[model samples]
Target: MDKIVLKNMAFYGYHGNLESEKSQGQRFFVDVEIKTDLTKPGQTDVLEDSINYVEVYDMVASIMTGESCNLLEHVGALIADSLYQHFQGIIGLSVAVRKPSVPIAGVLDYVEVVTTRGQI
Candidate 1:
């Protein structure tokens, strides 16, 4: 199996448990790791032979910016499900959703939820 990884794709979304979070929104970072066989694309050197990066990015962007979710876990699941539905060549995939502006009492960098689907 081969891999296609997209990292630190940032978006502004209203996704959190708190009221302020839902209203004000915050920055979210998503990282996706797609598992697939790259042999066809590697050999053909054609865009059609592989998963389109622009399409994947657009899909993620739509999901992240469109709806309001309560948990990062749900956001991660949405991305995984959307990818699986749209891309048939994917053997498996993982999505990591990061929330940097958390309402925690203590200071920290960020909170991230990771979800995986299929073989991955």
Candidate 2:
């Protein structure tokens, strides 16, 4: 199976268990991968024969922008569910959501989550 990967898509949003974290907001990174048959797109080389990743980006962006979910796991699962429900041909998908500059005293680059669905 061929894979399409989206890396480090960033967003600033209100998502956290703590009140301060939610009120202040924080940066989040999202990564996604989709498994598919590449032969059709490779043979025809048509945009329609394959997934338009721009749309995928838009979908994730919309999710981040439109709602406030307290858990990155929920956000990650939403992305995977969206892809799976929207595209039947997609054999499977993985989504990761990361939070950077967390409020805790300890230094950390980010907290990340990865969720996978379907056959891949």
Leading candidate by lDDT: 1
Clash pairs detected, candidate 2: none
lDDT of 1: 0.94
In order, what is each prediction's RMSD in angstroms? 0.7, 1.2
Among the numbered candidates, top TM-score falls to: 1
Every candidate's lDDT: 0.94, 0.86
**On residues 8-40, what C-alpha lDDT tens digit does candidate 2 reach at each position?**
998888887888877888788899999988889
lDDT of 1 at 116: 95
**Model 1 lDDT per residue over 1-120, tens place:** 799999999999999999999999999999999999999999999999999978999999999998899989899999999999999799999999999999999998899999999898
- TM-score, candidate 2, is 0.92
- Candidate 2 off by > 4 Å: none
Q: Which pairs of residues collide in candidate 1?
A: none
Give the residue spans of candidate 1 off by over 4 A.
none
